[model samples]
Target: MSAGETVHLTLDEVRALAKAGLAKTGLSPDHVDAVAETMVSGERDGCASHGIYRLLVAASSVKSGVVVPDAVPELSEPSPALVRVDGKGGFAQLPFRLGAPLLAEKARKFGIAAMGLNNVVHFAALWPEVEELTRQGLVALAVTPSHAWVAPAGGTKPVFGTNPIAFGWPRSSGEPFIFDFATSAVARGEIELHRRAGKPVPDDWGYNADGHATTVAEEVLSGAMRTFGGHKGSALAAMVELLGGPLIGDMTSLQSIEADGGRGGSPIGGEFIIAIDPAGFVGDLLAEYMKHAEVMFETITGQGARLPSQRRYEARKKSLVQGVEIPAALMRDIEKLLEES
Candidate 1:
């Protein structure tokens, strides 16, 4: 495929192609549907890092036994407000799907609840989990760590993952306010995409082996990715490591690869989610607070500052009508997988 050549396709097309490819890789029918839906959601929301670009990687992982295809999530609530989900070494979506509603229910009863999903392979974006809780009328926070790729502040050695975190707050009306971000200067998948396209990244994105910042994507991939805000981002990354890793009795960034004997697939990790019901604290006051927030949001937009998740919401609307555009090369790859299936 030539540069800039793309194929415009609807969400259904993307999902059908992903389902066929994943099914061919031996993922169970239900698992295939779950993963495909999550992937299509990413594409719909303009998250290229977690969209169709990840389908082939997921298929490869399943084929190589890195991700167990038919694994089922196990949920156990040892405490009234605490939930533990075992992903059975499978994809994260299945475990999260089973545990999130339970967490929300617990939060509604007890004011707050937390869930930890362990022994899972999380390859997609984290916003979906928190957004689901918000849709259930709860505020939510979700965090997950990954294999080490990001360097700590002032250090060349990579000690942290590009650990992404997401938060959502339910509104009285309209969609929830949501934000998802990577602690690193850029998401690891974005860097990988640039490398694949033979493009140079920003000089501040990552450092070479000698600890010198470089724009060459290949060098950054071979070396260490930098934290977004130097020490501050490094600190947040550490917080995620503790919350999503050891806090959940799961492996930390460095331990992920070790646990898997360096098989080199998606990050094998844990997911930590917290849900809070506004009615628990101040029911009527919460509605008033949202009104104030809406006024502030209007003011912010009036000043031309975009709210978090605005781009994603707009992208979803556009994608629904105009369809998503996938690179010709990527479409060809998906088509090949479909043909094989």
Candidate 2:
């Protein structure tokens, strides 16, 4: 490719590249495939922060011993409606995969179930797990802790992770309603991407060491990411931290970092996922529920509103035909890793 030229790759190509690179880092075949699909989905859905750009960092984490590429998740049940998984210091996806089906089964039988995942590292978007649950006719909510990079309201230093939360509500047909976001003003990875490309972030996105806001991506990263809505978002982040960490017998972002010798990589924490079966409670009422929900949806969209996952769905549709785009520099970096591997 010429200087500054971008590369477009089919979804299969992206997945193959990611799988090969991740496998070379010593991840087991299943683990490599899981991570590759997650990463490629990010690119296909236009979530650049969590997409192929993350592969290098993931590789680094494996090398740094922060992630056990070949580790397997262990599942256990503490109650009829509670499912738990220990990731054994591996990626979060495997644990979710190990536990989700059990949770779904219990939820179907008991109306609701919770899956607690500990000793895991989450470096990808949270929607995939919850969205998959929705496909099984369940509503789902998932939260995961990350590195402490967001400040509580009125604070200088960061005390919370970007702390993403994802929720999915299954529709009667077609795509489900799914939404995922970081409680921080912006995702931490977006800032890192800006820093990598030598760009500035918005002032509201973060603070410097002195607690003053700044646009310099590197400075923001050096200090703290900001809460999206002042105290409100901070509170949500705190909730996620407690749910994904302490409540799940894992460390909060700060605690994880302190325990891990202050290493900078994807966080070692936990995930909390809740699956609720609407049919168990409503049964035939579900159709009525859908009717009411669709009425509200149609009313909102009539006024030019849109559903939460619409953008992602549109992006996915386009990517199916046009392929995923990789920045020239990033492609070169991945190629170098492939060569090294």
Candidate 3:
């Protein structure tokens, strides 16, 4: 296939590609499974940045020696409504998988609960964690920091990570209402993809080392990224930094990047997740409150306004039946990692 051509792959094929690539890196079977599932879901739902493309990044992390391929997460409960897990320097997926059940249970018992995951190397989006809690019939919010890449609003230096926040709300029927977005103008991965494709970025997405805005992807990669919505986005990014960092007794984005020591692996830090159970608050009037939420959703969609994650859900349905398409060039990159094994 031509470099720019697309290749269609079923979800199973996507899983196999992820698993094979990760397994060759000496990651344990369980970690491989968890990571592969996250990648497959990203591809199935049309998130190319987080999909099979991540295999190359994961493989590089293994080579960096910063990640423990077989590290097992350890869990503890310091309070009735709080759960904590230490990832032991492993990827975040397995830790979240191990702690999610207890988190949901605590939320159901106490009306609300919080989970803190520390020392985990984060790479994927936060949506998977919150979405898992929503499947257990709770409202969930999750946030995490990454390596410092984006600059604070109106600043020239890099301080904040992409600092994504994800939220999930359970509904009586159909898919949960979910949103996951970076506080920055765009995800760092998107810029990296542009660089790989030999393309320049939008004028506002990144700035050079001297704080001058530029369209060159390489400059942004070396310099800093701009936050979305100017100062408003900066404030939200600060909230994410505090919530996912000091509040959890873990490293902030700056600290996380410093700890990396320029190894260029995933960010080592904490993620804070909160889950709320409506039944605990409404008791017998759960249906009444749910009706109110449905009306809100209806009002928004009725006006032809698309809800958050609507396009993703629609893409998911189509991919399930028709499979998904990825760039031929990215396919070759994934194949190369497996070949190197």
Candidate 4:
């Protein structure tokens, strides 16, 4: 299978396959629909690593009783502008869908609102949630701590998750200015991809079991993934853990081990989202913000820099105009899974 080979599947075909796969495991149609929608959106947005590639893990987690398919979110109002939700071990998207709109409405009224979500599985990418808030004409910031995969600076052992943080601002153009990234040297999904492909990681991406830097994905997976920028990344990751972790009273990576039968637990990740109404802060802020952003963006591009989301946005546009280019290996895996189903 070549690395860049493309496979074309219509949106309906992809969703149908995901729904059928989930249904075979006794998942409800509603759950299947929601999950399938998220997965398809990820693929359409050119985030295939977090798309159907994760279906097997998600379904297995549900079937193994690690994730409660029908779990309900427990809401608590600690303050007028702050809401906390205990996911009760459900899929992460459940609380995201529920809380995002609530926060948006609250922000519209209060100028700003924040929600803390805990006890949910990994929420895929942060773009989807942020896009929703942007569509509502609000700026949104979402941060989450996942299963511990990256090591702290100067530490050999893994002590923190990849710790993704995302921010989104409304733009008048084709897409919102969305930025999502992991604090780790590389994303866990990328490492997993390398492992699945039997390829080595980059030397700077991780360390060996002996605490020495290495390019071997298996070694890093068995040992510790590196922090992105030494202490800076570690500090950011620590902040994410505190804000997205115990503040909401959810299980950290270490705490999750007790629940997931010791294979790193069920990814009881924690998340925090802040929504801000631009108009509340300043009149016609979107127009002004976009104007300034364009100037700065042009300056940077002129100096040989690209905006944060430009690559993904370009890939998405091309995919929509042409077709999604799924790698050959991923296509083969999808076919194999369909055959098994």
Q: What is the C-alpha RMSD of each candidate to the true structure, in Å?
A: 1.9, 2.1, 1.9, 2.5
Task: Show where candidate 2 strays beyond 4 Å.
Answer: 1-4, 193-200
The predicted structure with the larger TM-score, 3 or 4, is 3
After superposition, which runs of candidate 3 have C-alpha atoms over 4 Å from their true positions?
1-3, 197-199
- The better-scoring model by lDDT among 3 and 4 is 3
Error of 2 at 7 (Å): 2.1
Query: What residue runs in model 1 are displaced by over 4 Å at the alpha carbon?
Result: 1-3, 197-200
lDDT-superior candidate, 1 or 4: 1
Cα lDDT tens digits for candidate 2, 92-203: 8888887888999999989999999999987888998888899998999999878888899988698998898999998886688999988998877688778988888888
For 1-341, candidate 3 gives per-residue lDDT tens digits of: 13478999999999998999999999999999999999998898888878888888888888898889999999999788999999999999999999999998899888999999999988898887778888889999998888788898879789899999899999988888999999999988789888888898998998888889999998998899989999999988888899889998899899998999988878999999999997987899999999899999999999999989898899899999999999998888877777883
At residue 334, give the lDDT of candidate 1: 77
lDDT of each: 0.87, 0.88, 0.90, 0.78
The window of 10 residues in a row where model 2 has the poorest summed lDDT is 1-10
| Cα lDDT over the full model 2 | 0.88
Q: What TM-score would candidate 2 get against the native?
A: 0.94
Superposition error at 302 for model 3 (Å): 1.2
